[model samples]
Target: MDYQIARHNMVENQVRTNKVTDPLVIAAMEEVPRELFLPEAKRGVAYVDEDIAVGGGRYAMEPMVIARLMQCAEIAETDVALIIGAGYGYGAALLSRVAETVVAVESDKDMTASAEATFQSANYDNVIVVEGDLAAGYPNQAPYNVIVFDGAVTEVPAGVLEQVSEGGRLLAVVRAEGKVGIARLYERENGVIGHRDLFDANIPYLPGFEPTESFVF
Candidate 1:
């Protein structure tokens, strides 16, 4: 399979056509070898317009979703970004090229191990892969300039929000009422958060973010 051609099509048809015009984001997506993130059997489908499963019932978001989220974040070269669900560290690698540092969090131990190996193999020194619960964002490296939830979630975990610095930005595909939309949230000065729905999208649901039941009085 011509991975380069597929990546080009993904950038042109999936990303640019969908209004993801950030040059840095486009270049990062084009340069990142997505095939390296997927299992050997699924490498051929790395550039396809679909989610590639990365175990633990989670999946890498499709190219359009990733591009849209990156565009929304407006990643800066000096920004410190946190990527939830690192998978095989593809997103982290992409962000590392644009951001000053990328702290990628993965809940699954196996996935974290794989990501660490991939990072070492690729000689990526800026990406830090940590294994922990997805709902609990990495606070030790708190006050991130940008926070990216790599998969869909029913709600933005409060712990994750606490990790964002004031005026920081967060991008995630939020699932509600069986519909998924890319939601952008910003931290405000008054210790509050504001959110805006960017666009509808389909992304794999992240573990530990399922909605809990409530009893009516």
Candidate 2:
């Protein structure tokens, strides 16, 4: 397959057409070889419009959703980012270009290993893949200038928010209401965390981030 062409089309059609107008985000998305982050067999569908499973019940979110999150984060060149649930590291790769450093945490050992190999092969020296509990976040690299949840979650845990430095930004897809989910952008201000709903997205939820049941028989 002509991956370069497919990457370009994904950027133009799936991403740009969907209101992801940030030039920095667009350029980073266009440059990352997304197919490399997928399992060899799954690479065939890397640029598809929907999310694809990356093993252990985790998924790499749809390109448009990823692009929107990137735009919302407003990653600065000097920023250090933390990516929760870094599926196959595609999101980290994209963010690495926009942000100075990235710490991607993944709970699945296999996925973490693959992501590390992929990042190394791609020469993404600034992006580090760390094995850890996704919900716990990677606090050892605390005080991130930007934090992004790579998959949908029920809520942004306080632990994660506490890691964001003052004036830093965070973006996540929160499972909301009965229908579509809400894409939220959070900012740290005066030692407080505030968020704005940027858009609605229905990306697949990261396994452990789902909301708990109210009752069980």
Candidate 3:
């Protein structure tokens, strides 16, 4: 399928045109084989400008959305990252390339095992895929310099926000009013986290991370 060409097009067209100008992200996205994270049957559409479903209600986020989030996160070469809802580990792979280390938290054991296998196959040695609750974040590796949610969420849990290191960054597609989500970036400084709405994004919600319903009177 000339995947190299497809990857190039994805970066030059889908990503760059969408305000994702970080060279590290552009280079990482260009090199990482997106199809490797998808089921064999779905590899053909890996470069398409759409979210690729993996399984268990999780999806590999659309290329442009991911790229823009990464750019907004402002990843540093020495930063340690935590990826929530790792899914097929595509985002972890990309994060590993930009950051020094990436710890991916996933709820399903089978998915974690599969993600580990894919990481090994792809030689993503800086990534660790572990089975854990997506909403809980990976506190064992707490104080991460960067934390990224792989899908949209109604709100970022406080517990999850507490794990970011002082001066760290967190990026997510936060569900907003009008049934839409906004790509938001948060920075922690002086023990306080500040967020900025980056752009609008429509992505799948992470399984089990949805906010609990509140009864309306």
Candidate 4:
């Protein structure tokens, strides 16, 4: 399949039409080859509007959702970014274009290997892939200028929020059981963190990040 043409249509039809107006985000989305991040069999559908499962209960978020979230984060050229549950590193590859450095964390070893190899092969030198617990943000390089949860989460962990630098931005899709997901943008200002809902999304939740069940008496 002609991925470049498919990618162009994805940006113009799926991404841009969905209110993702950030030029930087659009350009990065356009430049990154989404097909390379998927399994060989799934590459043909890489540019489709729905999320594609990438193994280990992870889904590469749809293009519009990711692009909108990235636009909400307002990534800057000098920002140090972190991508939790980075999967095959497609989002990290896109973030590498605008952020100064990208730290992509994934728990699945196979995905980690794929992400690392893909980054190296694509000459995305600014991205660093690490394997670790998805709930626990990479503290080795705490205080990132921008942080993104690559998929939906039941809730945002306080520990991860603590990792955001002052005036930094963090983006995530928060969903609860039987409830719709909402994309939110969190910002740290004067040592306090606040968030506002940006849009509604239904991206699949990242593994192990689901909220615990509450039993009724």
Candidate 5:
């Protein structure tokens, strides 16, 4: 299969048509070889419109959703970004093309190993895949210009939001169990963070971000 053509189609038919207009985001999506991020068996469906499983109960996220999230972040050439639960490193690779550096945090050991190998082979050196608690947000590299949750999350930890530098942005698909998800863009301004809903999405929940249960007395 001609991945180039398939990628182009994905960008045109799936992403661009869905209101993802950022030129840099589009360029990055087009340049990255997404198939390389997946297991060989899954590579055949790399450019498909839906999310694909990448092990440890995480999904790579749909292309349109990923592109919209990146677009909402408004990534810059010199920005330092962080991606939480970046399964298979596809989102990291896409962000690496537009940001100066990207810290991809994944809790699964095997997934991290595979992602690192994929990044190395693809020469996406700007992205650093680290194995750790996904909700912790890789605090060692705090003050990120862009923080992206590669999948749906029920809530954003305050500590994680604190990692965004003043004037930076955080993007995520916020959803509760048995409900529709909303893509949100959060911005830190003057040390205060606020968010606005961008769009609706229903991607899989990240492993550690499931909503907590409440009791009724």
Candidate 6:
């Protein structure tokens, strides 16, 4: 398959059309080889407009969704970024090119191992892949400039929010009322969080963030 052509089409047709006009995000989507992040069996469809399943109930989000989220995050060259569910490190690699540093958290051992290998192979010096629960953001590298959840979640884990610095931006697809919306959240000066819905989007649900059952009389 002509992966390059497909990637280019994804950027021009899907991302740009959807209002993801950030230059850094467009470049990252064009430069990063999405195929490298998927398993060999799924590499052929890497550039397709669909999420690539990465096992353990996780998936690498579709390119346009990721692009839109990154654009909303407003990544800066000097920004320290944290990527949750860093499947195969594709999102981390993309952010690494735009941010000063990237800390990627992955819960699945196999995905973490694969991401580490991909990082090494890509010579990504600014990316650190750590294996842990995705719901618990990497706190040791606290106060990140930007936080990106690679997949949708029913709720933003408090643990993840605590890792963001005051005024830091967080972009994630949040599920509510049987609908999913791209929610952009920012830490306020008063230590409160403010959120605004950007657009409706469908993304794979992140593990460990499912809504709990409430018993009723």
Top-lDDT structure, candidate number: 4
Clashes of each: 0, 0, 0, 0, 0, 0
- Expressed as tens digits, the lDDT of each residue in 34-115 for candidate 3 is 8888878789999999998877777889999888888888899999999999888889999988999999998978778888
Q: Write the per-residue lDDT of candidate 2 for residues 1-217, one digit (tens) a residue.
A: 9999999999988998998899999999889999999999899999999999877888889999989898888889999999999988999999999999999999989889999998887799999999999888999999999999998998988988999999999999999546688999999999999999988899888988887767767
Return the candidate ranking by lDDT, descending. Answer: 4, 5, 2, 3, 6, 1
Q: Could you tell which candidate, 1 or 3, scores higher by TM-score? A: 3
Worst 10 residues of 3 by lDDT: 205-214
TM-score of 6: 0.94
C-alpha positional error of residue 28 in candidate 3 after TM-score superposition, expressed in Å:
0.3
Better of 1 and 2 by TM-score: 2
Q: Which model, 4 or 6, shows the larger TM-score? A: 4
Better of 5 and 6 by TM-score: 5
Better of 2 and 3 by lDDT: 2
Estimate the TM-score of every prediction: 0.93, 0.97, 0.95, 0.98, 0.97, 0.94
1-217: candidate 1 lDDT, tens digit per residue: 8888888888888788888888999999888889888878778788878888866687888888888788888888989999998887888888998999999999888889888999889888999999988888899889898999888888888878888887788888888646655565555456788888888787778777765666899
lDDT tens digits, residues 1-217, model 6?
8989988988888889889888888999899888888888888888878888877787888888888888888888999999998988888988998999999999889889998998898898999999988888989899898999988888888888877788788888887646655555655466887778887787778887655667899
Error of 2 at 209 (Å): 0.9
Clashes of 4: 0
lDDT winner between 5 and 6, please give it. 5
- Write one digit per residue (lDDT tens) for candidate 5, span 1-217: 9999999999999999999898999999899988988888898999999999866687878999999889888889999999998778889999999999999998888889999998887788888999999888999999999999988999998989999999999998999888999999999999899999998999989987888888999
Q: Give the higher-lDDT candidate: 1 or 6.
A: 6
Candidate 4 residues lying further than 4 Å off, grouped into runs, are none
Scanning candidate 1 in windows of ten residues, the lowest lDDT window is 180-189
Give model 3's TM-score versus the native structure.
0.95
Q: Tell me the lDDT of candidate 6.
A: 0.85
Off by over 4 Å in 1: 213-217
What is the C-alpha local distance difference test score of candidate 5? 0.91
